[model samples]
Target: MIHITRTLSIPDSEIQEQFIRASGPGGQNVNKVSSAVQLRFDVARSPSLPEAVRARLTVLAGRRINQEGILTIEAQRFRTQGRNRDDARVRLVELIRRATEVPELRRATKPTRASQRRRLESKQKHGDTKKQRRSVGPSDG
Candidate 1:
Protein backbone atom coordinates (compact mmCIF):
# COMPACT_ATOMS: atom_id res chain seq x y z
CA MET A 1 0.00 0.00 0.00
CA ILE A 2 1.19 3.50 -0.83
CA HIS A 3 0.31 6.05 1.80
CA ILE A 4 -0.64 9.39 0.30
CA THR A 5 -1.85 10.85 3.57
CA ARG A 6 -3.10 9.70 6.95
CA THR A 7 -6.60 9.42 5.52
CA LEU A 8 -5.65 8.21 2.07
CA SER A 9 -3.77 5.10 0.94
CA ILE A 10 -3.48 3.62 -2.51
CA PRO A 11 -3.20 -0.11 -3.06
CA ASP A 12 -0.46 -1.62 -5.21
CA SER A 13 -3.02 -3.11 -7.58
CA GLU A 14 -4.04 0.27 -8.95
CA ILE A 15 -0.63 1.11 -10.40
CA GLN A 16 0.58 -0.30 -13.70
CA GLU A 17 4.13 -0.12 -15.01
CA GLN A 18 5.66 -0.46 -18.46
CA PHE A 19 9.31 -0.69 -19.41
CA ILE A 20 10.76 1.03 -22.47
CA ARG A 21 14.12 2.15 -23.83
CA ALA A 22 15.60 5.24 -22.17
CA SER A 23 16.48 8.03 -24.59
CA GLY A 24 19.66 9.57 -23.13
CA PRO A 25 23.20 9.05 -21.70
CA GLY A 26 23.86 5.28 -21.73
CA GLY A 27 25.68 4.32 -24.93
CA GLN A 28 25.44 0.74 -26.33
CA ASN A 29 23.50 -0.40 -23.26
CA VAL A 30 20.81 2.13 -24.05
CA ASN A 31 20.21 0.50 -27.42
CA LYS A 32 20.06 -3.00 -25.94
CA VAL A 33 18.39 -2.61 -22.51
CA SER A 34 15.09 -1.02 -21.62
CA SER A 35 15.92 1.18 -18.64
CA ALA A 36 13.02 3.62 -18.62
CA VAL A 37 9.97 3.10 -16.48
CA GLN A 38 6.53 4.34 -17.33
CA LEU A 39 4.22 4.47 -14.36
CA ARG A 40 0.50 4.72 -15.00
CA PHE A 41 -2.19 5.46 -12.47
CA ASP A 42 -5.87 5.96 -13.16
CA VAL A 43 -6.98 9.04 -11.30
CA ALA A 44 -10.67 8.58 -12.08
CA ARG A 45 -10.83 5.01 -10.80
CA SER A 46 -8.61 5.16 -7.73
CA PRO A 47 -10.51 4.39 -4.55
CA SER A 48 -7.71 5.81 -2.41
CA LEU A 49 -8.15 9.50 -3.27
CA PRO A 50 -10.93 11.67 -1.85
CA GLU A 51 -13.17 13.47 -4.34
CA ALA A 52 -11.50 16.84 -3.72
CA VAL A 53 -8.03 15.34 -4.08
CA ARG A 54 -8.98 13.61 -7.31
CA ALA A 55 -10.30 16.90 -8.67
CA ARG A 56 -7.08 18.74 -7.80
CA LEU A 57 -4.92 15.92 -9.18
CA THR A 58 -6.71 16.18 -12.49
CA VAL A 59 -5.98 19.89 -12.69
CA LEU A 60 -2.35 19.49 -11.56
CA ALA A 61 -1.59 16.72 -14.02
CA GLY A 62 -2.59 18.95 -16.97
CA ARG A 63 -1.41 17.34 -20.24
CA ARG A 64 -0.01 14.29 -18.43
CA ILE A 65 -3.49 13.03 -17.68
CA ASN A 66 -5.21 11.71 -20.77
CA GLN A 67 -8.90 12.12 -21.63
CA GLU A 68 -9.42 8.69 -20.12
CA GLY A 69 -8.14 10.05 -16.78
CA ILE A 70 -4.87 8.13 -16.65
CA LEU A 71 -1.84 9.89 -15.13
CA THR A 72 1.40 8.79 -16.74
CA ILE A 73 4.84 9.36 -15.18
CA GLU A 74 8.06 8.49 -16.96
CA ALA A 75 11.37 8.00 -15.13
CA GLN A 76 14.63 7.27 -16.95
CA ARG A 77 17.29 8.90 -14.84
CA PHE A 78 19.20 5.72 -13.93
CA ARG A 79 21.13 3.26 -16.04
CA THR A 80 19.62 0.06 -14.62
CA GLN A 81 15.98 -0.99 -14.84
CA GLY A 82 15.77 -1.51 -11.07
CA ARG A 83 16.94 2.04 -10.38
CA ASN A 84 14.56 3.40 -13.00
CA ARG A 85 11.69 1.48 -11.45
CA ASP A 86 12.52 2.85 -8.01
CA ASP A 87 12.75 6.36 -9.43
CA ALA A 88 9.32 5.98 -11.00
CA ARG A 89 7.78 4.78 -7.74
CA VAL A 90 9.40 7.63 -5.84
CA ARG A 91 7.99 10.14 -8.31
CA LEU A 92 4.51 8.62 -7.97
CA VAL A 93 4.67 8.94 -4.20
CA GLU A 94 5.78 12.56 -4.44
CA LEU A 95 2.99 13.40 -6.86
CA ILE A 96 0.39 11.77 -4.65
CA ARG A 97 1.82 13.50 -1.60
CA ARG A 98 1.47 16.85 -3.33
CA ALA A 99 -2.07 16.08 -4.44
CA THR A 100 -3.06 15.01 -0.94
CA GLU A 101 -2.19 18.37 0.57
CA VAL A 102 -5.11 20.78 0.97
CA PRO A 103 -4.28 24.30 -0.06
CA GLU A 104 -4.99 27.10 2.40
CA LEU A 105 -7.95 29.28 1.46
CA ARG A 106 -6.85 32.74 0.37
CA ARG A 107 -8.58 35.59 2.15
CA ALA A 108 -9.54 38.34 -0.26
CA THR A 109 -8.18 41.71 0.80
CA LYS A 110 -8.51 45.08 -0.86
CA PRO A 111 -5.47 47.29 -1.58
CA THR A 112 -4.50 49.41 1.43
CA ARG A 113 -4.84 53.20 1.15
CA ALA A 114 -1.05 53.54 1.44
CA SER A 115 -0.49 51.10 -1.43
CA GLN A 116 -3.04 52.95 -3.56
CA ARG A 117 -1.27 56.23 -2.84
CA ARG A 118 2.10 54.72 -3.77
CA ARG A 119 0.70 53.41 -7.07
CA LEU A 120 -0.79 56.79 -7.88
CA GLU A 121 2.47 58.51 -6.95
CA SER A 122 4.43 56.29 -9.36
CA LYS A 123 1.93 56.94 -12.16
CA GLN A 124 2.06 60.66 -11.54
CA LYS A 125 5.85 60.66 -11.61
CA HIS A 126 5.82 58.77 -14.92
CA GLY A 127 3.27 61.19 -16.34
CA ASP A 128 5.37 64.19 -15.22
CA THR A 129 8.42 62.74 -16.96
CA LYS A 130 6.46 62.27 -20.18
CA LYS A 131 5.02 65.76 -19.90
CA GLN A 132 8.54 67.26 -19.72
CA ARG A 133 9.53 65.36 -22.89
CA ARG A 134 6.54 66.76 -24.87
CA SER A 135 7.15 69.45 -27.54
CA VAL A 136 6.45 72.95 -26.15
CA GLY A 137 3.76 75.15 -27.78
CA PRO A 138 4.82 78.19 -29.98
CA SER A 139 3.01 80.47 -27.47
CA ASP A 140 5.28 79.29 -24.57
CA GLY A 141 7.80 82.01 -25.51
Candidate 2:
Protein backbone atom coordinates (compact mmCIF):
# COMPACT_ATOMS: atom_id res chain seq x y z
CA MET A 1 0.00 0.00 0.00
CA ILE A 2 1.15 3.56 -0.79
CA HIS A 3 0.20 6.18 1.74
CA ILE A 4 -0.35 9.58 0.12
CA THR A 5 -1.67 11.49 3.11
CA ARG A 6 -2.81 10.75 6.66
CA THR A 7 -6.24 9.66 5.43
CA LEU A 8 -5.38 8.22 2.00
CA SER A 9 -3.72 4.95 1.09
CA ILE A 10 -3.60 3.32 -2.35
CA PRO A 11 -3.31 -0.43 -2.73
CA ASP A 12 -0.75 -2.06 -4.98
CA SER A 13 -3.55 -3.58 -7.02
CA GLU A 14 -4.55 -0.09 -8.10
CA ILE A 15 -1.28 0.30 -10.00
CA GLN A 16 -0.06 -1.66 -13.00
CA GLU A 17 3.54 -1.72 -14.21
CA GLN A 18 5.13 -2.78 -17.48
CA PHE A 19 8.80 -3.07 -18.35
CA ILE A 20 10.10 -1.90 -21.70
CA ARG A 21 13.53 -1.47 -23.32
CA ALA A 22 15.04 1.90 -22.42
CA SER A 23 17.28 4.02 -24.67
CA GLY A 24 19.36 5.98 -22.17
CA PRO A 25 22.43 5.70 -19.85
CA GLY A 26 23.03 1.90 -19.94
CA GLY A 27 25.13 1.89 -23.17
CA GLN A 28 25.30 -1.70 -24.56
CA ASN A 29 22.92 -3.02 -21.90
CA VAL A 30 20.31 -0.42 -22.86
CA ASN A 31 19.32 -2.37 -25.96
CA LYS A 32 19.39 -5.74 -24.17
CA VAL A 33 17.49 -4.94 -20.94
CA SER A 34 13.98 -3.67 -20.32
CA SER A 35 14.85 -1.12 -17.69
CA ALA A 36 12.18 1.51 -18.33
CA VAL A 37 9.06 1.24 -16.20
CA GLN A 38 5.64 2.23 -17.39
CA LEU A 39 3.24 2.66 -14.51
CA ARG A 40 -0.50 3.16 -14.95
CA PHE A 41 -3.11 3.98 -12.33
CA ASP A 42 -6.85 4.12 -12.86
CA VAL A 43 -7.77 7.39 -11.20
CA ALA A 44 -11.43 7.46 -12.17
CA ARG A 45 -12.40 4.12 -10.64
CA SER A 46 -10.10 4.04 -7.61
CA PRO A 47 -11.99 3.61 -4.35
CA SER A 48 -8.98 4.77 -2.36
CA LEU A 49 -9.29 8.37 -3.57
CA PRO A 50 -12.02 10.83 -2.68
CA GLU A 51 -14.08 12.29 -5.52
CA ALA A 52 -12.45 15.71 -5.14
CA VAL A 53 -8.94 14.29 -5.22
CA ARG A 54 -9.81 12.13 -8.23
CA ALA A 55 -11.06 15.17 -10.16
CA ARG A 56 -7.97 17.22 -9.31
CA LEU A 57 -5.69 14.29 -10.10
CA THR A 58 -7.22 13.98 -13.53
CA VAL A 59 -6.64 17.68 -14.16
CA LEU A 60 -3.11 17.53 -12.75
CA ALA A 61 -2.25 14.46 -14.84
CA GLY A 62 -3.04 16.44 -18.01
CA ARG A 63 -1.92 14.56 -21.16
CA ARG A 64 -0.63 11.71 -19.00
CA ILE A 65 -4.20 10.57 -18.35
CA ASN A 66 -6.04 8.90 -21.22
CA GLN A 67 -9.74 9.09 -22.01
CA GLU A 68 -10.16 5.89 -20.03
CA GLY A 69 -8.99 7.80 -16.90
CA ILE A 70 -5.80 5.79 -16.57
CA LEU A 71 -2.81 7.93 -15.58
CA THR A 72 0.44 6.72 -17.15
CA ILE A 73 3.88 7.65 -15.83
CA GLU A 74 7.05 6.50 -17.57
CA ALA A 75 10.24 6.29 -15.51
CA GLN A 76 13.59 5.75 -17.23
CA ARG A 77 15.84 8.20 -15.46
CA PHE A 78 18.04 5.45 -14.03
CA ARG A 79 19.81 2.57 -15.84
CA THR A 80 18.38 -0.08 -13.49
CA GLN A 81 14.82 -1.41 -13.62
CA GLY A 82 14.47 -1.37 -9.85
CA ARG A 83 15.32 2.29 -9.54
CA ASN A 84 13.00 3.20 -12.40
CA ARG A 85 10.18 1.21 -10.84
CA ASP A 86 10.68 2.90 -7.47
CA ASP A 87 10.91 6.30 -9.15
CA ALA A 88 7.59 5.76 -10.90
CA ARG A 89 5.84 4.73 -7.69
CA VAL A 90 7.35 7.66 -5.80
CA ARG A 91 6.16 10.06 -8.51
CA LEU A 92 2.66 8.58 -8.34
CA VAL A 93 2.52 9.05 -4.57
CA GLU A 94 3.75 12.64 -4.85
CA LEU A 95 1.14 13.40 -7.50
CA ILE A 96 -1.63 11.94 -5.36
CA ARG A 97 -0.40 13.91 -2.34
CA ARG A 98 -0.49 17.12 -4.35
CA ALA A 99 -4.04 16.42 -5.46
CA THR A 100 -5.11 15.87 -1.86
CA GLU A 101 -4.35 19.50 -0.95
CA VAL A 102 -7.31 21.85 -1.29
CA PRO A 103 -6.48 25.28 -2.66
CA GLU A 104 -7.47 28.27 -0.55
CA LEU A 105 -10.54 30.10 -1.81
CA ARG A 106 -10.01 33.71 -2.88
CA ARG A 107 -12.37 36.21 -1.31
CA ALA A 108 -13.31 39.36 -3.21
CA THR A 109 -11.88 42.50 -1.68
CA LYS A 110 -12.62 46.15 -2.39
CA PRO A 111 -9.67 48.56 -2.66
CA THR A 112 -9.05 50.45 0.58
CA ARG A 113 -9.71 54.24 0.58
CA ALA A 114 -5.99 55.02 1.02
CA SER A 115 -4.93 52.79 -1.86
CA GLN A 116 -7.61 54.21 -4.13
CA ARG A 117 -6.54 57.75 -3.31
CA ARG A 118 -2.90 56.87 -3.99
CA ARG A 119 -3.76 55.34 -7.33
CA LEU A 120 -5.77 58.41 -8.38
CA GLU A 121 -2.94 60.70 -7.25
CA SER A 122 -0.40 58.77 -9.31
CA LYS A 123 -2.63 58.94 -12.37
CA GLN A 124 -3.11 62.67 -11.97
CA LYS A 125 0.62 63.21 -11.57
CA HIS A 126 1.31 61.20 -14.72
CA GLY A 127 -1.29 63.22 -16.60
CA ASP A 128 0.33 66.49 -15.40
CA THR A 129 3.76 65.34 -16.62
CA LYS A 130 2.34 64.46 -20.03
CA LYS A 131 0.47 67.80 -20.19
CA GLN A 132 3.74 69.72 -19.57
CA ARG A 133 5.44 67.84 -22.44
CA ARG A 134 2.87 69.13 -24.97
CA SER A 135 4.32 71.36 -27.79
CA VAL A 136 4.17 75.09 -26.91
CA GLY A 137 1.45 76.79 -29.08
CA PRO A 138 1.64 80.38 -30.43
CA SER A 139 -1.26 81.36 -28.08
CA ASP A 140 0.78 80.34 -25.00
CA GLY A 141 1.60 83.24 -22.58
Candidate 3:
Protein backbone atom coordinates (compact mmCIF):
# COMPACT_ATOMS: atom_id res chain seq x y z
CA MET A 1 0.00 0.00 0.00
CA ILE A 2 1.21 3.52 -0.77
CA HIS A 3 0.28 6.08 1.87
CA ILE A 4 -0.26 9.57 0.49
CA THR A 5 -1.52 10.96 3.77
CA ARG A 6 -2.88 9.57 7.05
CA THR A 7 -6.37 9.40 5.50
CA LEU A 8 -5.30 8.42 1.96
CA SER A 9 -3.67 5.17 0.92
CA ILE A 10 -3.64 3.24 -2.32
CA PRO A 11 -3.06 -0.48 -2.75
CA ASP A 12 0.09 -1.54 -4.57
CA SER A 13 -2.02 -3.53 -7.01
CA GLU A 14 -3.31 -0.27 -8.49
CA ILE A 15 0.05 0.58 -10.05
CA GLN A 16 1.11 -1.15 -13.28
CA GLU A 17 4.74 -1.04 -14.38
CA GLN A 18 6.35 -1.78 -17.73
CA PHE A 19 10.07 -1.86 -18.47
CA ILE A 20 11.66 -0.54 -21.69
CA ARG A 21 15.22 0.13 -22.78
CA ALA A 22 16.62 3.50 -21.66
CA SER A 23 18.72 5.54 -24.11
CA GLY A 24 21.51 7.02 -22.02
CA PRO A 25 24.70 6.53 -19.91
CA GLY A 26 24.60 2.71 -19.74
CA GLY A 27 26.51 2.48 -23.13
CA GLN A 28 26.57 -1.18 -24.24
CA ASN A 29 24.45 -2.22 -21.24
CA VAL A 30 21.81 0.28 -22.30
CA ASN A 31 21.29 -1.57 -25.58
CA LYS A 32 20.93 -4.91 -23.78
CA VAL A 33 19.01 -4.09 -20.57
CA SER A 34 15.65 -2.39 -20.12
CA SER A 35 16.16 0.23 -17.40
CA ALA A 36 13.31 2.66 -17.97
CA VAL A 37 10.15 2.22 -15.94
CA GLN A 38 6.73 3.21 -17.22
CA LEU A 39 4.29 3.53 -14.34
CA ARG A 40 0.56 3.71 -15.09
CA PHE A 41 -2.32 4.43 -12.74
CA ASP A 42 -5.94 4.52 -13.87
CA VAL A 43 -7.25 7.68 -12.23
CA ALA A 44 -10.87 7.49 -13.41
CA ARG A 45 -11.41 3.90 -12.30
CA SER A 46 -9.47 3.96 -9.04
CA PRO A 47 -11.51 3.09 -5.96
CA SER A 48 -8.76 4.39 -3.68
CA LEU A 49 -9.07 8.05 -4.72
CA PRO A 50 -11.88 10.25 -3.49
CA GLU A 51 -13.98 12.10 -6.12
CA ALA A 52 -12.43 15.51 -5.41
CA VAL A 53 -8.92 14.12 -5.41
CA ARG A 54 -9.65 12.24 -8.62
CA ALA A 55 -10.78 15.44 -10.32
CA ARG A 56 -7.67 17.29 -9.15
CA LEU A 57 -5.44 14.40 -10.23
CA THR A 58 -6.92 14.50 -13.72
CA VAL A 59 -6.23 18.23 -13.96
CA LEU A 60 -2.74 17.88 -12.52
CA ALA A 61 -1.83 14.95 -14.74
CA GLY A 62 -2.50 17.09 -17.88
CA ARG A 63 -0.85 15.57 -20.97
CA ARG A 64 0.25 12.54 -18.98
CA ILE A 65 -3.34 11.36 -18.65
CA ASN A 66 -4.87 9.97 -21.82
CA GLN A 67 -8.57 9.78 -22.85
CA GLU A 68 -8.70 6.46 -21.03
CA GLY A 69 -7.75 8.36 -17.84
CA ILE A 70 -4.51 6.46 -17.32
CA LEU A 71 -1.78 8.59 -15.82
CA THR A 72 1.62 7.50 -17.22
CA ILE A 73 4.86 8.53 -15.60
CA GLU A 74 8.15 7.63 -17.28
CA ALA A 75 11.26 7.32 -15.13
CA GLN A 76 14.55 7.05 -16.98
CA ARG A 77 16.76 9.34 -14.93
CA PHE A 78 18.43 6.36 -13.25
CA ARG A 79 20.36 3.69 -15.21
CA THR A 80 19.03 0.81 -13.07
CA GLN A 81 15.48 -0.50 -13.28
CA GLY A 82 15.08 -0.65 -9.49
CA ARG A 83 16.03 3.01 -9.02
CA ASN A 84 13.84 4.10 -11.93
CA ARG A 85 10.92 2.10 -10.56
CA ASP A 86 11.35 3.64 -7.13
CA ASP A 87 11.58 7.10 -8.71
CA ALA A 88 8.31 6.52 -10.60
CA ARG A 89 6.54 5.34 -7.43
CA VAL A 90 7.85 8.34 -5.50
CA ARG A 91 6.56 10.72 -8.16
CA LEU A 92 3.12 9.07 -8.13
CA VAL A 93 2.91 9.38 -4.35
CA GLU A 94 3.92 13.04 -4.51
CA LEU A 95 1.30 13.73 -7.19
CA ILE A 96 -1.42 12.01 -5.19
CA ARG A 97 -0.41 13.88 -2.03
CA ARG A 98 -0.69 17.15 -3.90
CA ALA A 99 -4.10 16.17 -5.27
CA THR A 100 -5.32 15.41 -1.75
CA GLU A 101 -4.72 18.98 -0.63
CA VAL A 102 -7.75 21.29 -0.66
CA PRO A 103 -7.19 24.50 -2.55
CA GLU A 104 -8.05 27.73 -0.75
CA LEU A 105 -11.17 29.43 -2.05
CA ARG A 106 -10.58 32.74 -3.79
CA ARG A 107 -12.86 35.47 -2.45
CA ALA A 108 -13.88 38.21 -4.83
CA THR A 109 -12.82 41.63 -3.55
CA LYS A 110 -13.53 45.16 -4.74
CA PRO A 111 -10.97 47.94 -4.73
CA THR A 112 -11.03 50.11 -1.62
CA ARG A 113 -12.50 53.60 -2.06
CA ALA A 114 -9.16 55.22 -1.15
CA SER A 115 -7.32 53.07 -3.70
CA GLN A 116 -9.88 53.84 -6.39
CA ARG A 117 -9.58 57.54 -5.67
CA ARG A 118 -5.80 57.36 -5.78
CA ARG A 119 -5.88 55.51 -9.12
CA LEU A 120 -8.21 58.07 -10.65
CA GLU A 121 -6.06 60.91 -9.25
CA SER A 122 -2.93 59.32 -10.74
CA LYS A 123 -4.65 58.97 -14.12
CA GLN A 124 -5.77 62.60 -14.07
CA LYS A 125 -2.26 63.75 -13.16
CA HIS A 126 -0.80 61.71 -16.02
CA GLY A 127 -3.33 63.10 -18.49
CA ASP A 128 -2.52 66.68 -17.33
CA THR A 129 1.21 66.00 -17.84
CA LYS A 130 0.57 64.75 -21.36
CA LYS A 131 -1.68 67.81 -22.10
CA GLN A 132 1.13 70.16 -20.96
CA ARG A 133 3.49 68.45 -23.41
CA ARG A 134 1.22 69.39 -26.34
CA SER A 135 2.19 72.51 -28.37
CA VAL A 136 -0.01 75.65 -27.93
CA GLY A 137 -2.18 76.39 -31.01
CA PRO A 138 -2.05 79.86 -32.67
CA SER A 139 -5.76 80.37 -31.80
CA ASP A 140 -4.80 80.75 -28.11
CA GLY A 141 -5.78 84.48 -28.07
Per TM-score, the best of the predicted structures is 2
TM for every model, in the order presented, reads 0.83, 0.89, 0.88
lDDT of 2 by residue, 72-91 (tens): 99999999999999999999
Better of 1 and 2 by lDDT: 2
The C-alpha lDDT values of all candidates are: 0.90, 0.94, 0.95
Q: Which residue pairs of candidate 3 clash?
A: none
Given candidate 3, what's the lDDT at residue 23?
A: 79
Q: What's the lDDT for residue 86 in model 3? A: 97
- From the highest TM-score down, the ranking of the candidates is 2, 3, 1
Residue by residue across 25-124, what tens digits does model 1's lDDT show? 9889999999899999999998878898899899888898999999999999999999999888887888778877889999999999999999999999
The alpha-carbon deviation from the true structure for residue 84 of candidate 1, after best TM-score superposition, in angstroms, is 1.1
Two-way TM-score contest, 2 vs 3, winner: 2
